[model samples]
Target: MNLLHIDSSILGDHSVSRKVSAAAVVAIVAANPGVKVTYRDLDAAPAPHQSGALLAARLLDPGARSADQARDITEADAVLDEFLAADIVVIGAPMYNFGIPSTLKSWIDHLAIAGKTFSYSEAGVQGLAGGKRLILASSRGGFYGADSPMAAVQHQESYLRDFFRFIGIPDVEVVSAEGVNYGPDHKQKALDGAVAEAANLGRALQAA
Candidate 1:
C-alpha cells in the first residue's frame, strides 16, 4: 500500500497537530508493514497557486500550451497523480482564523481540476477520485462539534467534505482537536480526546 502524508502546520516543533499526524502515520505504517510513505510538507515546500496562464493551458491542448505554461500544468498534474496513486491519505491541517491554511487550499486548488478530479455530467458533477480513504487531522482553538454552541460556525470540516465528495472521495474520516488555545485544562482535555481517537482509528485502519 502507498500512503501520502501531508502536513500544513507552520508551528514546527510546537505543533500538536503534527504530533498527532505523526502518531497516526506510525499507526498506519505499523499496521501495514510494507506501506510506502510519501511526505509533503506544505509549509516547507509550498505548491504554486494556479494563475490565469495555467488556466489557459488547461483549457487548451498540449500542442497549444506554451513551454512555460506546459511546465506549470505538468507540475500540478504530477501532484494530482501522486494524490490519485495513494491508497490512503493522511493530512494535518490546523485551523487559521476559522479556515484552513492558504497553503493547503492552494494544494487543493491544484488537484481539483475539471476532467481530472471531477467532471460535469448530465446527472451532475461526477467525481473521478474514488475508492480511497482520506483521514484528516484538524486542530482548532474552539469547539465546533454538535454539542458546542459554535457548531454552526464550522465550515472547515464541511467544506473539506464537500470538496472531497465533489471529487468522488466520500469515505472521509475526520479527527478534530479543538479548544487548544482555550487553556491548559481545556487543551489537555481536547488533546487527550484526540490522542485516543487517533489511536483507535489507527488500529482500525491497520486491521483493515
Candidate 2:
C-alpha cells in the first residue's frame, strides 16, 4: 500500500498535529511492512496558488495554451496525480484562527479539478475519486465540541470533511488533539488520547 502524508503546520517542530501525524504514519508502516510512504510538507514546499495567467489558460482551449501556461497547469496536475495514486492519505491539519491553514487549502483547490476528481449531474455533484482512505490528524488550541459555545466557529474539521466527501473519499477519519491552549495538563491528555486512537485506526487499516 502507498500512503501519502501531508503536513501543513507553520509551527514546524512545535506543531502538535505534526507529532500525531508522524505517530500515525509510524503505526501504519509498522502494521504493513514495506508500505511505501510519500511525504509532502506543505509549509516547507507550498503548492503554488493559481495565478491569473494560469486561470486564463484554463479558460482557453487546451491546444491554445502557451508553453508557460501549460507548464504551470502541469505542476498542479502532478500534485493531483499523486493524490489519486495513494491508497491512504494522512494529513496534518492544525487549526489556524478557527480554520485550516492556507497551504492546505491551496492543495485542496488543486485536487478539486472538474471532470478529473468530480462532476456535476442531475442528482447533484458526483465524486469520481472514491474508495481511498482519508485520515485527518488535526489539532486545535481550544475545545469546540458539540456542546461548546465555539462549536459553530470551528471550520477546519467540517470544511475538510466536506471537501473529502465532495471528491468521493467517503472513508474519512479524524483524530483531533484539541485544547492545547488549555495548558500542559490538557495538552498531554489530548495527545495521549489521539495517539491511542491513531494506533487503533492503523490496525483497522492493516486488517482491511
Candidate 3:
C-alpha cells in the first residue's frame, strides 16, 4: 500500500501535530509491514499559490505554454499524481487563526483540479477519488469541538472535513489535540491523548 504523509507545521520540533503525525505513521508501518510511505513537509517546501499565469497555462495547449508556466503546471500535475496514487493519506494540520495553514491550503489547491479529482455531469458532481482513506492529525490552541463555546468559529477541522467530502472522501478520521495552550499540564495531557488516538487509528487502518 502507498501512504502519503504530509506535515504542514512550521514549528518543526515544537509542533504537536508533527509529533502525533509521526507516531501515526510509525504505528501504520508497524501494523502493516512493507507499506510504502511518502512524506511531504509543506513548511520545508511549500507549494506555490495559484496565480493567473498558472491558470492560463492550464487552459492553454501544451505547446503554447511559456517555459515558466509549463514548469509550474508540471509541478502541480506531480502533486495531483502523488495524491491520486496514494491509497491512504495522512495530514498534520495546525490551526492558525482558526484556519489551516496557508502552505497546506496551497497544496490542496494543487490537488483540486476539476477534471482530475472531480467532474460535473448530468448527475451533478462526481468525485473520482472516492476510495482513498484520509487521516488528519490536528492541533489547536483552544477547544473547538461541538461542545465547545467556540465551536461556531472553528474552521480548521470543519474546512478540512468539507474539502475531503467534496472530493468524495466523506469518512475522514481526525485525531485532534485541543487546548494545548491552556497550560503546561493541559498541553501534556492533550498531546498524550492525541498520540494514543493516532496509534489506535493507525491500527484500525491496518485492520481495515
Candidate 4:
C-alpha cells in the first residue's frame, strides 16, 4: 500500500499535531506490512500559493513557460500527483486562527484541479478522487467540540472534512488532541486520548 504522510506544523518538536501524526504513522506501519510511506513536511517545504500569473502559465505550452513558471508548475504537479497516488493519506493539521495552517491549504490547492480531482457535469459536480482512506491528526489549543462553547467558531476540522468530501472522500478519520494549550495536565490528557485513538485506527485498518 502507498501511504502519503503530510505534516504542516511549524512548531516542530513542540507540536502536538506532529507527535500525534507520527504516532499514527508508526502504528499504521507496524500493523500493515510492506506499506510504502512518503512523508512531506509542509512547514519546512511549503506549497506555493496559487496566483494569477501561475494560473496563466498552465494555459501556455511547456516550451513557452519561463524558467520560474516551469519550476512552479512542476512543484504543483508533483504535489497533485502525490495525492493521486496515495492509498492512505495521513495529515497533521494544527488549528491556526480558528482554521488550518496556510501551508496545508496551499498544498490542497493543487489537489483540487478541475479534471484531475473533480469535474463539473450536467448532473452537477462529480469528484474523481475516491476509494482512498484519509486520517487527520488535528491539534487544537482549545475545546471546539459540539458541546464546547467555541464550537461555532471552529473552521479547522469542519473545513477539512468538507474539502475532502468535495473530492469524493467523505470518510475521514480524525484523531484530535484538543485543549493542548489549556494546561500541562489538559495537554497530556488530550494527547493521550489522540494517540490511543490513532492506535485504534491503525488496528482497525489492519483488520480491514
**What are the lDDT scores of the predictions, listed in order?**
0.84, 0.89, 0.91, 0.92
Candidate ranking under TM-score, highest first, comes to 4, 3, 2, 1
Superposed model 3: Cα runs more than 4 Å off: 59-67
Error of 3 at 131 (Å): 0.8
lDDT of 4 by residue, 109-166 (tens): 9999899999999999888899999999999999999899999999999999999999
What is candidate 1's lDDT per residue for 75-120, written digit by digit as tens?
7887788898988888898888767889899889978878988999
Q: Where does model 4 exceed 4 Å of error?
A: none
Error of 1 at 171 (Å): 2.2
Comparing 2 and 4 on lDDT, the stronger one = 4
Return the top candidate by lDDT. Answer: 4
What tens-digit string does per-residue lDDT give for candidate 3 at 123-195?
9988778899899999999999999989999999999999888888999999999999999999999999999
TM-scores vs. true structure, each candidate: 0.89, 0.91, 0.94, 0.96
TM for candidate 4 is: 0.96
Residue 114 error for model 4, in Å?
Answer: 1.3
TM-score, candidate 3, is: 0.94
In TM-score terms, candidate 2 sits at 0.91
Pairs with steric clashes in candidate 3: none
- Specify the highest-TM-score model's number: 4
